[model samples]
Structures are given as structure tokens and as C-alpha cells.
Target: MTTVRIPAGWPATEEQARAVQDELRERVVTDEPGPPPRTGQVTGVDVAYDDERDVVVAAAVVLDAADLTVVAEATAVGTVSFPYVPGLLAFREIPTVLAALDALPCRPGLVVCDGYGLAHPRRFGLASHLGVLTGLPTIGVAKNPFTFTYDDPGIPRGSVSPLRADADEVGRALRTREGVKPVFVSVGHRVTLDNACAHALALTPEYRLPETTRRADALCRRALREATA
Candidate 1:
């Protein structure tokens, strides 16, 4: 595990954070198709918070894209840099997440964030922010669609529907299992929306959530417990 500290001059107000978001949002790439599914390495990144302690723990778990076997993992604990604000939650987690990813032994080919990307109200979320900073391909596989509206997808595995904000389609609600609630997938950086959905499905072969997410989630929570203890 690694320890991280908030950078100097980190945003202290919502206005400052939103200004940063607006500037960085323009740097997010959306043209590249990114790496193909079931190839190279795919990493899942998640964070756990202990608000009372003002601490957050982040975990990054890299898996072989073909078989979903764990290749490498790292964790970082840090002071929460920002308060719990909806749509701006990434600021609280990114520093620790960056430390965790930096500690990994090998390259993280495609990063999967357990949060939003283009599906965000500002069109820039954790995955996009991480990608822009690290120059890595990334996508978001979120459990909920945030404020986006979507029609129900078919009751079958691999079915999908557009997640819309008003008239613009921002992402997809992708069903990874039959009769299960779909996961929301969106382009983060260097990836298209269709490819993002495909990667989400490829990662979720056995459950509603991807193995990468499941592993990272558990590891982050464990790291948080250990840090707080």
C-alpha cells in the first residue's frame, strides 16, 4: 500500500472544482477505439472512504483481458481532498487512485473506473479525469445511470439501450446477465461508446459487475479497513 497527500493548491470550493472540470473536460479524447476487448491488460479502479476519519483508500487491480485472471494490484490511502459533493466526487478519490495506479508493477492497458465518464452531467467523470491525467485508455462501468434516463433493455444478456440526457445519448445501459439490471457504460478517453459497452460485457462474464470491479472494490474496502484500524 502507498500513502498519498492532497496536492498543493487543490481546489477548496465547488466553483474552483467545477472550473477545473470544465477546463479538463475539453481534453478528453473520444475518437480512438482503444484496445480491443480480451486483449492486453485491463485494470479496474475503485475507492472506499471513511468520511469520519477524512480518509480514502483506492485500489487498482489489473487483469488479463482474455481470462480475467489477476495480474497485479495496488492500494493507496490518503486524506480526502474534497467534501462529498455529487458529480464532483472524483476529486476526493483521484489522488489516492493515482498513487495506487502508480504503484502497480506493470502497465495498465485499459482502466475501468467504478464510476461515470461521458455519462456525467459535466461530461467528465473519474474515468475521464484519470485517463486525461495518465494518458491511458479508460472507461466507466457504473452501477447506476446517475441522472440519465434510459429505456429498459431486453431481458437477455448483451442487450443494451441508450442512456440519454435530454435528446443527446451519452452512454449505454448494458445488460451483462439475463434478467439483471444493466450496468451503465460510457466512453472515458481514447474509446468509443460502442467499444466501451463491448468491453463492459467482456469483463462481466460471470456477474452483474465486472471481475475487475469486484476485485478492486473488495481490495479498496479492505485497504480502508486496515488504514482506519
Candidate 2:
């Protein structure tokens, strides 16, 4: 595990954080179709928090895109960089996540975040922030569409509906399993929305959540427990 420290000049208030978001949001690339699904290494990044202890633990698990096999994993623990805030939650998580990713032994080809990207109120979420910082092809596979509206998809695997913000389509609600609730997918950076959803499906061959997410989520939670214990 890597240890993390809050970067100097990190956003100290909601206004500062939002200002940072506004500036970085403009840099998020949405034109390119990222790496083809299931072709290269794909990594899942997730964080666990112990608010009472002011500790955050982040995990990055790299998987072989073709077979969903784990290739490398790293964890980082740090003081929570920011206070609890809704849309700005990424600020609290990003520092340790970057540290975890930096500690990884292998290159993380396409990163999958267990949070939002373009499907955000500010149109810049964890995945987008991380992508812009690392210049990686990244996507978000979220369990819930935060404040967004989407029609229920068909009761079959691979079904999808547009995740909308008013009239503009921001992301997708993708059904990875028959009769299952859809996972929200969004373009983070250097990836198209369609390709992002395709990668989400490719990562979910066995579960409603992507294997990358499932594995990283478990690892981060465990790391948090160990750190706190």
C-alpha cells in the first residue's frame, strides 16, 4: 500500500472545488473511441472511507481485458482530502486513487471508475477528473444514475437507454444481465459513450457489476478495514 498526502493548494472550499471542476471539465475529451473492448488491460478504481478516522483507502486493480483475469493491484491510504460533498465527492477520493494507480506495477490501459463521468450535474465526475489528470482512456460504470433520468431498459442483457440530463443525453443505462437493474455508463475522457457502454458490458460477463469493479471494491474495503483495525 502507498501512503498519500493531500497536495498543497488542494481545493479548500466548495467554490474552489467547483471552480477547479469547471476548468478541468473543459479538457475532458469525448471525441475518441477508446481502446476496443476486451483488447488491452482495463483497470477498476474504487475507494473506501472511514469518515470517523478521516481515512480513505483507494484500490486499483488491473485486469487482462480479454479474460477478466487480474494482472496487478495496488492500494493507497490517506487522510480524506476534502469534506463530504455531493457532486464534489471526487475531490475527497482522487488523491489516494492517484497514488494507488501510481503504485501499480503495470500500465492501466482503460480505467473504469465506480462512479460517474459525463453523467454528472457538473458533467465532470471522478472518472473524468482522473482521466484528464492522467490522460488515460477512462469510463464510469456507476451503480446508480445520480439525479439523472432514464427509461427502464428492456428485460434482456445488453439492453440500453439514454441517461439524460434534461434534453441532452449524457450517458447510458446499460443492462448487463437479464432482468437486472442497469448500470450507468459515461464517457470519462478519450472515449465515446457507445464505446464506454461496450466496455462496461465486456467487463460484466458474470455479474451485474463489472469484475473490475467487484474486485477493486472488495479490495479497497478490505484495505480500509485493515488500515483502520
Q: Pick the candidate with the highest lDDT.
A: 2
Q: Which ten residues in a row have the lowest lDDT in candidate 1?
A: 84-93
How many residue pairs clash in each candidate at the backbone level?
Answer: 0, 0
TM-score of each: 0.98, 0.99
Candidate 1 residue-wise lDDT, 1-229, digit = tens: 7889999988999999999999988888999999999999999999999989898999999999999999999999899899989899888889899999999999999999998888999999888999998999999999998999999999999999999999999999999999999999999999999899989999988899999999999999998898899
Checking candidate 2 for backbone clashes, the offending pairs are: none
Question: Which stretches of model 2 miss by more than 4 angstroms?
Answer: none
Worst 10 residues of 2 by lDDT: 83-92
